[model samples]
Target: MVDRPRKPSALATTPGLPPQPQVAFSADNSSVTATLPTGESVSVLLYGATVVSWKDKKGEEKLWLSEAARLDGSRPVRGGIPLVFPVFGTAPDHAQTKALPQHGFARSSRWEFLGKSTSESTPTPTTPAFAATATSAAGAVAAAAADMSVKLDFGLSSSGLSEDARAKWPYAFNAIYSVTLNTDSLTTNLVVTNDDDKSWECQVLMHTYLRVDDITTTTISGLQNATYTDKTTSPISSSTQSSPLLTISSETDRVYTPAGDSPASVPIVVSSDNKPKFTILRDNLSNVVVWNPWVEKAQGMADFEPKDGYKQMLCVEPGAVGTWQVLEPGDAFEGAQTIVLGGKTE
Candidate 1:
């Protein structure tokens, strides 16, 4: 079982209404933050519904975000969870993806705030013609100390997309993203329904950036012995990880694809000095993309900023990248990843 910090419960001594999530605007009012009672909270932007920050009960960030990350809606946010959909990092058979944005329009395109699961917000996240049923949603977010979970859904569809985006990939679809926050872990669930007659293949990923004291000092487990395509190499060679503790000392980019008979829930352990800080459990996501732009590459990118910002963060993404997830007509696909905080033995 997962181990979380033993927090004192106040409900037993002081009786009151269960603290509802304060779904309010940030001080700047440009973004919204869901402040959970458990002291763990997540901030999101209405622009792309991009999750910008997720903090634990101690108010420490589990995710790594660039100091220069933009929130003006000009481009895809540089950090947090930049939703990658329809296509992932320019694949082979996706003809339309080449012409459109880098990781498909989902991240770049604006999404409508369909509101909360309760009546306070809108009923659903779709347009008048395509709102889906509640089955698209999973369990709600659990309080920092409470038993029940809190859930909020965001709607994005072909109809709600911009003209330029719709012209690029014409497929009727409803994408309902329900973000449920638990006491120890925050779950991101993506439910995609193909409303069109033709089937389509796509890739989706939560390009998650994790924060660390130093990138080079951390070792990532759970991927050892798995086959991976080394993108850092010229010809892109594939190899099996021999080391039980995979350490990153230089510029690294690799995609790990497990065997068909591998365990369904792969636990990727992130640790410092042999003590785990947190564990990322990926469900239905067989691939893990590990990347850190070390020196020269970090200087060239405008988003990385400060020239040496790569030392503080790492991207250990879980998604369907090696192969594609196909959705037939009227079919729905659900994929999720849960990040459970470790003992914090720092």
Candidate 2:
């Protein structure tokens, strides 16, 4: 997969590398401080808009988004990025599902960084990189002289809602959430707009949790035949599968559906068995979620790690799961996902 070339400002250009650091925010902007070119330095916090912590490059705390519920205790507050929607897990008034907690509150609520632009002209380089393309329909498109990509836009206001999201599901919808990072890939675009006129049936997901090293020597390569649904027992078990390149071994959740448009390139290869370097690439997302909890739900979780952190990490995610996407009124729906880190290019 050897491509490499587009580096004009992937937030400070990085050809032979070594510049990187220039994603500031926080002057009451709430937080978003990337600075990686290996100097590592992520810091995304927006008070419940979620992503409360992400310290690496010698700081530690890789990933884990909330733990401490050995069935009912509490500590919640683990990693970054966690925004499932309308309803992601559990619902049937289990006491209003503990009054709306446990993965629904938009990763904790509070996200507003709608500012950043570049590109009105300038685009003509392509062979390995340097594209641009993003006229209007959102905005911003730059690439070259060091690399730069913008499409930033986020919303869900009322000072970022939370009265348990207006008493569990009251509608008045508006969610943009668009992001684009360069130097290979990081694209994310989610548009959910329904200004309440009628029709609204949510069930969306984006629980992206990636930070690997082991996960028992990772290997995810696009779902071969795709057609799953096995959210852990009880009247839920569809088939027409194809994903047995095995190696997981325990508590694994599943949900896939993609057999058209020839879209499939999931690759998750981690191989820390000594030498295989790193690999990530999740192009446009076609759906591939393979989880692990092992040990009877890791003994009920309180931060999960027993079993040697379940061999480290692995969570393929790019979703729609359990079906529920019905927007009317003002109607709007968009989805795109991509993440392409380095290593592996034979």
| Best-performing candidate as measured by lDDT | 1
Q: Show how many residue pairs clash in every candidate, following the order shown.
A: 5, 14
What is the C-alpha local distance difference test score of each model?
Answer: 0.75, 0.55
What is candidate 2's lDDT per residue for 1-346, written digit by digit as tens? Answer: 8666884644654343224345787776666655443333444555433444444445554444444312111223443445566666766653323345555666566666665443222334442333333442112222232354334456675336867577776677777675554443445567778887677666556666666676677656445576778778788888855664435677888877656674435554444454433354444445656676766886676566453555566665665544567788888766655554445442
Model 1: colliding residue pairs: 38-144, 64-209, 141-149, 141-150, 142-149
User: In angstroms, how far off is 346's CA in candidate 2?
Assistant: 14
Model 2 segments more than 4 A misplaced: 1-83, 93-113, 117-143, 158-165, 169-178, 187-229, 232-338, 341-346
Cα lDDT for residue 67, candidate 1:
74
**lDDT score, candidate 2, position 256:** 71
